[model samples]
Target: MSEAMKILFVEDEEALGMVVSDSLRSRGFEVDYHTDGESALQAALENRYDVLVLDVMLPKMDGFSMAREYRKSNRSTPIIFLTARSQTEDVVEGFELGGNDYLKKPFSMEELIVRVKSLAGCALNQENSELEECFVGKYKFSIQKQMLELNGKVKSLTHREAQVLHMLFEKRNQVLERKQVLDQLWGDDSFFNARSMDVFITRLRKYLRDDPSIQIVNIRGIGYKLML
Candidate 1:
């Protein structure tokens, strides 16, 4: 209900795809239906959709292969797989391939609608949180993708780099205590864990080196502060 969500639905079953696509359209969603994997992948690459509902079994390329290609380009779009394959290994493989959620076939229409709406809502909320561009010197920091882009070149950050940078950006120009940062990030202040936090801080500082205006100052016996 927040915004009209565009959904790309890739199901091979003609009758079921029609029913599901019609139901979604009736409920204020814009649905794009594709019956084959090749066309589904083409549609997905050609257009941007809020969520993707894919069936594993398909003609030509499979759902897993399609998801892999999307991820290689750093597309963080959430995917929900709907397949009759209910084996645990299949589920695990789906997740490992970056599938966010999975639903077995013979699922309820209501359930599918609810799940899609919920996931889309979550994605929208995340987008809203990062509405403003984070200008750390010449680079534009994208919190959602955890990437720093400068002059058309982008560098991806590791998970720790992303998390630490997020916290620092949230408290820009404020001193974040070492213990507090450690506890908040690593969930502990033990000697070994403290070392890990130091490594992350070092990596973040290196990544933000392009921006002379931004510096992570270390306060002895205290913590770090983002000097902007």
Candidate 2:
């Protein structure tokens, strides 16, 4: 068998932590569990983990703050935030802090497993590793460089923006649901995230404005479809 993936899990709740840690281990993940954010952050910085599962409410520091600090030195490890709070702003804050996924409390082990597996698969996709360039309309996008080139002019994209555009291009000519985009990118489909997605969509529209052949259409109440 292949070596098990390492995971750093931080949760303040004793019972929940035990259950989740055990469950993940049973699924072949090697988990290092911590009960506070300060220690968790230290552990994360000291070791390399394939994924980080963090709870928003914790002692010393919260998950949001821990994630922000961790992102300063490490930008590649995927983070999943677990919280009881379902507020839109909280969800937005998690994403803004560099979290890759979010899970609300009272969640089932099955759902958590699915999310973990999906994230792992996305992170390890060989296609993304092999493919460096994608074409949309008259523009050329360099996946490795995170840049868009049109008519000899190049534009840089933020990490989140590049991720969003990458997904849209992957699903070109197909309707990509709003919730799907939110879940894949921000980890939740909260109202605030939906609004934030709109802003990204608008920015992408401006970037592709020079090419009339490319269009990102909003399917009112549904999602968006990128035409090229």
**Which pairs of residues collide in candidate 2?**
none
**Residue pairs clashing, model 1:** none
List lDDT for all candidates, in order. Answer: 0.75, 0.82
lDDT of 1: 0.75
> Candidate 2, after superposition: displacement of residue 210 in Å?
13
By TM-score, the best candidate is 2
The C-alpha TM-scores of every prediction are 0.58, 0.72
182-206 per-residue lDDT for model 2 (tens digits): 8876567877668667777887898
lDDT of 1 by residue, 26-140 (tens): 9899999999889888888889888989999988989999888876764456688899987767776776666656777899988787667655544224555744458776789
Q: Per-candidate RMSD vs. true structure?
A: 8.8, 4.7
Name the TM-score of candidate 1. Answer: 0.58
Candidate 1 residue-pair clash tally: 0
